[model samples]
Target: MPKKTEYVLRLYVTGASPNSIKAINNIKSICEIYLAGKYALEIVDIYQEAEVAKKEQIIALPLLIKKFPLPEKRLIGDMSETEKVLKGLGLQS
Candidate 1:
């Protein structure tokens, strides 16, 4: 069988803020339900990794970057909207 396409996701957020926490939970839930074992998620706290944030050029507090599978995409928000998140991740039409 062919291997499933693996997704690489990087979530950048500030320290423990409400929006950051919400974005984490929301993205996790989405990944569990949709991406399942086919995704690698990396959460980066700008406070702890300022250099990473600088390198990534993150201007927003809560940002989700789909780094793998080509055509990299970015979404910025708390990620409360499931449909929007799904669409952003290329899981929905």
Candidate 2:
């Protein structure tokens, strides 16, 4: 079982593209609603910090990663699909 109200997330995005912006905003909104202050969000802009992205082995933009509470998970896209995003991070039933 996992501890309550603990989350560590990393979002990797490109420049200021629409999809990237949408991904950042959507993840922020979701995390605020669901994880709130218990969450630690790290936003990495690949265009500005490609080193970080390379270290993470990211090949694409707008990637959301849940990296705590045991096994990690990754989600790619603008994060418009709640179910997919939640399930990817083991947040849904």
Candidate 3:
């Protein structure tokens, strides 16, 4: 049997901006529907924790990083594009 994959995701946002809020909500919804009990999500507010963003080399306001399961993936913007985000995370809609 194949080993189950556990997803480790990091979301970097700047304060409570609309794009940031949208990204957070979208990712949470996706995780609940797809990753459910097998995922760890860390939401980082760059405005409050600038060092984290700098250390992660975040260039965008709302960025999603899939840190686990090898070949880490990154998604930028508001994360409103569900299909694209899902594809980036190697998941089917």
Candidate 4:
């Protein structure tokens, strides 16, 4: 049997702005529905952790990074578009 893929996600945001909140909610919903207990999600507020942003080279306000399962992927936006976000995260075609 094939091993189930585990997801390691990192979300970079700018404080509690609406866009950031939306991104968080959207990703959380996606994780719960799709990843369901097989994922690790870390939220980094660039406003608080400037160093992390610099290290990650985050150029967008709301950024999502899939760090595990090989071939790292990144998506930028509020994450409100479920289809696009899923596609970006390789959850959908």
Candidate 4 regions with alpha-carbon error over 4 angstroms = 1-5
- Looking at model 3, how many pairs of residues clash? 0
Least well predicted 10-residue stretch by lDDT in candidate 3: 1-10
lDDT of 1 at 57: 84
What would the per-residue lDDT of candidate 2 be over residues 1-93, giving only the tens digit for each residue? 554658889898887999999999999988888777788899987888868776888976699888896688888999999888878877786
Candidate 3's displacement at residue 22, Å, is: 0.5
Model 3, residue 58: distance off in Å is 1.1
Candidate 1 matches the true fold with a TM-score of 0.91
Worst 10 residues of 1 by lDDT: 1-10
- Better by TM-score, candidate 3 or 1: 1
- Of the candidates shown, which would achieve the greatest lDDT relative to the real structure? 1
As a whole number from 0 to 100, the lDDT of residue 67 in candidate 2 is: 87
For residues 35-90, write the lDDT of model 3, one tens digit per residue: 87888899988888878776888897799999997789999999898899999999
lDDT, candidates in the order shown: 0.92, 0.85, 0.89, 0.90
Instruction: List the RMSD of every prediction in angstroms.
Output: 2.0, 3.4, 3.1, 2.8
In candidate 3, which residue pairs clash? Answer: none
**What tens-digit string does per-residue lDDT give for candidate 1 at 1-93?**
654759999999899999999999999999999998889899988899889877888898799999987799999999999999999999998
Better of 2 and 4 by TM-score: 4
